[model samples]
Target: MQTRNGDLSQQNGAESNSSSNHWQSQIAAVTRKLGSLPVQELKLRLPDWRNSLSTSENRLCDLLLAIQCSNSAADIHPKLTQARQEYEKFKFLCQTAQRVLTQNLTHYDLVSIAKISTTVSQPNTHDSAAGRSPALPVALRDRGSFDHFMQMWCIMTKHNVENMPKMGYKLLDLFQLYIQVEELGGLEKVDTEGLWHLVASKMGHVPNSQDATPISHIVKILSGAFVSVLAPFEEFYKERMRRTAAHWNICGPNVTPGTGIVPTEVHCNIANFGVVFGEVNIGLNDWMPEWSPYAKILRLTGMDLDQMQQQGWTDDLIRLITKFKPTIDAWREVLIKFLLEIWQHSQSMTGQHSLQHPCRPTIQFPTSQVPCEVASTIKGAFSIDEMQRAKLVVERLTQDILQTRQYQTCEVPEVQRLQMNYAVVDAHSLAIQFERIASLDYIVFDDQERTKTHLDQIALLKEQHQILQSGQQYYIMSLEEVVTAQQNFRTALGGIKNACVQKVKERQQQVTINFPQPDEFLIRSLLIKKS
Candidate 1:
């Protein structure tokens, strides 16, 4: 019984050794197969076989090298083919990690490496050997231990991709990579042509090529893989852009160019927005009426006066007279008629004949001397107070008449006849002067006070005449002296009339009359007082 028990123990020990030998033979065969592939072929196939039993072409290559340099499989504890494959996969991951570090890397590249490493390192039931230990050779096992080191390498190389030139790589290469990854059922699926079209659209390039298979075709083929490879980089760039945009306070909804149409997202935050400015109307046919006789007269007079003044008439007084000649002529006729009518009325009040004794003879006294007793008795028939009152009435009446003529009605034939008969051909000659005065809103009245004082002096002379006549002192003055004084008075009156007309013309020339004002009444009052 003791002999049989020993035999059984020996038989079991032989079986255990045979099982280990079988594993050793399998491991040796795989190591030989791995070693047979050239380094160039390994490098070329690394990316393709990354998820295979070899982990990647680089890991397989590294494993083959490691196995070739190590002691024989029989001397060391041998592992199963499955164990060898896992070992190869682990070694491939290590080599891939090293390669990844050697090249320029990015955060996305590191992430991919991490994922691939995790997948390779995870143990599977399919990887268990039937007769041998599941653990690999010590040299091969060292590859798995290098995982932490690979991760650190990835971290160190993460910033390298940033150093790449923007246009160094062809845009089409990225497109093809994207398509391949999509076909492999990677993270994302993208339509290659559609993506190209989208990019082309953004760039405003029309996809109207004549070639059946253009460069755009290759771009389409690679689009999916391109997107996959670039997605992380794109995300990284997008994150950077987002941060930059935030820094610039540029967070806002998309807006259409040229239309000023705000998106709903931004519209809600707008407090007050408006576009009140507009182009001014500059259309044809905005000119003043063509048939306006007053406008025509104003144009003619203005042109003529400007021409006259341009002919070296620098004296303000002369320029003033020339500028207002037409208006002064009109006012002179009106004043003469008005004064004649007043004298006729006064003569009738005194029971005197205007044709025989004529009211003109009453005012024919020297401006500087007293009137004789005969003319004084004639003036006494109307008291000095009554004469002054008459003059005031004449002034007010003339003002009303001038204003009524100017604003109440358009130029009719009868009105023109009345104006022409009064000796003025045009009323608009005064428009320029009146316009200049009115524009000031009377603010510059002080500048014109000297002219007003001159007018007051004329008024005082007329008053003195009436006072002398009422005191019966007109006989002391000779007929020749009286005629001379009367002529001087008429010339002074013409000057005053010319001055007023020139002022009106100047005002009209400088300002544009769009609306009426109280100055119109003042102008008419002055006209009436002159008359």
Candidate 2:
């Protein structure tokens, strides 16, 4: 009976295998009959099909569960089995097609991420040298193969979390390669055409039908507002130059070549800057990445953005892109550190060890700037009542900023001496760090009275910062003066000590001279008296 059972099981397995093969062959035949689809069309069509398939799959799953729970369903079991087999084969084909389409879509959106080999171009021609640059990576050279990527980067929006980490590493790798190449004395560039050939080849092979975004179109639109703010036009508000002026700060006070640029030197519609650049207050719990200034250009890409968010693809790609930003930041950090290291190296060569250089980032972090601004305005308070109110506000703001980071130093009322922290090596030192002290919150009422009150508070806050800053400078100056005075005193004391020692030696010699034999003479006189 056991051997019979085994034979029966083997026969059933063979039948199931044959059924699966028949289903696949029918699906292949249907796919060949339908032919291929364009990418844009596929992008639009696939999501609908997927949603329908999901609904069907869920219903089929429920039916299968019911079938498993039923003992009296043997008569209809063969029909149910055939339907399940067909559905499985169809689902497989759909998934495989979607995967291929996604790959094709990814190929179209290749950002220019490559190895960075720096070429120094100083103002002097003699110093400028375009050395051999490092070769671009496979991801850049053969962009079709993004599977083997070092980093994936994205501008952080809610949609792109999936791809962000990979994107970040890609950019980091690119930057790392740049530093490595620069360090290795690679200055000359690789052939531009050859690098792009990989992209062209990918595009040619893909069925997207010139679906990749053209370089010329992007360049033209983005650069549409390129104009010198100095060249004033009558219809400046309507002109694209307005955007340029607002962005570049071309006409501003203290930026005068011939004469100082007036506030109205160049006119622009402030609205052109967009909501991304505008400041917005958020509740402590809210996350609003789309409003960041860093996402301004991306937001400006206009109508195409709406379509991109239609499916999960946007989220996936965006995540990929956003992930690259940190690595880009890491790249920026590398550049900054390299520049600062150059400054440090020069300082070392010039024998300025006492003037210490920053090792870790000296750039302010986990610090509040709003408080500092409030503190500054309080320094300009004109009235006594206003000044008092400002001080109270400043004191509160001081507490707010202080609470941001863990510090051993207790918050003090009086201004504390801010340290020259660049000279210090220990990260955990409790010495007074250069910190933003305080800033007043925005006025609740728009009246001059309220504005004046806020400004006065900031002015009072500013006074404390001023005191702290001035005190630090004065302490340094006083320390130098005290050191110089002590050095002078020590030199004079040393000379006086040498003279006193010489005088003591000479006086002792004089006092002891030729008196050794007097005792012997007295001894002789005593002997004569005795005889």
Candidate 3:
């Protein structure tokens, strides 16, 4: 009974094998029939017949293995050619079918077909010059073939527009990840083009139509993603600004503490903001003319204030100007006081007395002869003369003040004493010579004492002249030193101005998006506010 069971099992296995062989033979018959046709006829027949053909990997692998093993050369060449042509035709049909089924198609499918067709068309190790077969393992000798197979796999997996959003999201995530990694290592590690190319290649497919809504959506998504990714950098910049402001004290007024007076804290704050928002306030130039109250005052001053009020003034500037008003008033008072003192000195020196006071001067022009119209016409001339006279007075006063201030401010009393003593010695030497000469004189006879006294007096006079000359030289040297000190102070002030200007320019470049015209009042307001 066991033997009978075993025999029955063997019989069933044999029948199964026979049935598989029968189906294989049927498929081979159909393959050969298609292979025998001309290329054009094959192309026409493929579209209708390819749907019935098996596309399973196992079946394709089986067919390819059989083709490699085939010994009949004449039959194999025709069969291989036919198989290649049919495969290409089928590929085209699949692509067309995909296009019809979906508006969007994935690159994976195209890549897969291209790779598979290339692999199927490639020559096996078995083929030779004389149609002889070489003995080599199908897998071992088919590395290029394997590569083509993988390429086909990639092609078969192509995506459509329906899947594009997902792909785009993936691309954005990939870019973000790369950016984070690059940042961690430093900016040098980032290869922008390489990463962009990789992502773009994966997501660059578009439908053949004018419909751009989908693409636009993708672009918007990308923009949002980029903004999100760069958000951290904003804080970085803010922190940098904070640290810089602290280190440089750039927020404070650009004034030295002791050398001269400077604008108030409010003025400095406004100036610093102007520096910080330089470029951004360019449009403020246009607004200034419309907004600034000081512009009207400037015009009334007849001071060419038109050029001063260009731009960057805003409503907030009123606070700054108000805050700095004390400093401005003080400066004005200093200037006025200096002018009054100069006018008083001029009157004293020129002996030109006025009915008002000894320090004031009066003009002697006849009031009746000159008509008001003529006087108005010549007023500019008289004004010019007055200005020239005032300037002369101021110049002399400046020189005298400088000289007295130098002496008064000197810490070393010995230096002054040396100077006074040098003058006194010179005077004493002159007086002694005169006295000696008066005492020794001869009329008729040649008196040796008189001649000697005269010669001695001449020598004393020469010595006194030398001492006076030396004292003058020393005084000139001291004055030159003082001038140099003043010049250094001026240079330092200039350096400060240049530094402020440079800072302002840099800030302007950073912040200003637009610049107003030169004659706008906004500029004057901004200047005043900043000051």
Candidate 4:
């Protein structure tokens, strides 16, 4: 009896398998027959065959679902492709019908078209959550929003709305998702093409030509805008990364063994030039640990990573991120330690390290204008009239040399050798740095207002520097003239002294000639007196 029961089970299993095969074969035959129909014939005769085609489509969807439920969708991709082609053919027919009616269609006629458009655009369950519109249904919303946000920046009236094109509802959702991600500071992390692929897959949007849907085209358009902001921010982020690596390379374990103390210049460089990255505002004050800028950036990046993982990131991406953990950890640890050391050193030297007056590093100008401008400003501030007068004196002396022709062969050195008593040139260089530091020092990590103010101050400084640099050329030229005049004067004085000495010698020779008989006269007078 047990053997007979086993035999009956085997027989039933074989019959079930045979039935599935027959069903699959029949589905294949229908797909082949549908494929052979000419596009024109289908267009002209679709209405006659619409009911039969609908019936066949319903059967095919049912079978596909069954295959998915049984975990066998992977075994028959060819049949699925044929089924998809037939579905697209139907979509084409609908599109053709819409074109025919569009010119004559009334507002009432548009209602069904709108409904059909909305139905087609609705996202599947897989790509629904992030993209689902909060205000309007997918069918009711303006499709223009997917292409350009500015077009729908305000309340979009019907007049401004474009005619609905063939696009997936999921595609709209993807754009919405892009907007959300941008708002949330995920623009830097967005992989536009990968994101499209992921979202399309989730939304059950298969790319096909016959459907006439510009889903890919829309995504490409959306992606261009999406990545526009990203490129600049990424450049800045990579610049930060490069700086971080450079700092680590310079001051890390490779530092010569005896240099226990980190250099002040190193501390200043990191403090002044290092930028804050991964900045996010969670809208909660005092929620962070000690309010370090680096800490905030680190937290933001970590949170972004968490979001990526939560959004069904692939294993390869996960692995790539995991590989970076050691570097990230090392950087974090090294930075914390270095900043701590700087703080301690400051405290030891100043009795208290004031966060209110944080180390403001020197702000360098893009041009060599800073030093030149500062110098010129210093010169002007100290004694503008005196410098101009001194310049006039040099110019007059230069005119004398040119008019006299004696010093014509002489050339002034590139740099003037004049000894200036005015202390502003030295003070100007220090003052520029001092003022920048003062502005930056007042900017606390949490004060956005102060940070903006600091940036404005830097801009002002740059402007002043440029103005000073322009003024410096005149001052420098004047200085060179003064030095040259002084040199020429010394040369003229030496020449005059030599001429006087020569004249004196000639007078001595004349005196010697006149006094040649003086000794004989003295002898004659002495002899007469003795007689």
lDDT of each: 0.35, 0.33, 0.35, 0.38
Query: Where does the lowest 10-residue lDDT sum fall in candidate 3?
Result: 350-359
Off by over 4 Å in 3: 1-314, 350-466, 469-531
The residue pairs in collision within model 4 are 121-169
Best by TM-score: 2
For candidate 4, write residues 1-531 as lDDT tens digits. Answer: 999999999999999999999977975675555546554554556565566468658867976886878766676667767777777666645434422222122222223322322232222222233543322323223446333322221112111123222243422344454444433334333453255544444444546667655677755644564454323333333333334334334333322222222343333122211111111211212345344333333443454566656747566655554544444444444445444443343222211122111112111232223233223222322234644554454345434444653212233243431222111232233233433322222221234343333333333333333323332211222334333433332333234334333433555544322211333332332233211
Cα-based RMSD of candidate 2: 32.6
lDDT string for model 1 (72-127, tens) is: 65533333344566766666544443233222222233233222222222221122
Clash counts per candidate, in order, are 39, 44, 29, 1
**Error of model 2, residue 312, in angstroms:** 30
Off by over 4 Å in 2: 1-36, 69-72, 111-531
**Tens-digit lDDT track for model 3 on 128-225?**
24323222212223445433322222222222223222433343342343233333332222233223333222445333467643554544454344
The 10-residue segment of model 4 with minimum total lDDT is 354-363
Estimate the lDDT of model 2: 0.33
Query: lDDT of candidate 1 vs native?
Result: 0.35
**Number of the top-ranking candidate, with lDDT as the measure:** 4
User: What is residue 430's positional error in candidate 1, in angstroms?
Assistant: 77
Deviation from native of the Cα of residue 235 in model 1, angstroms: 2.6
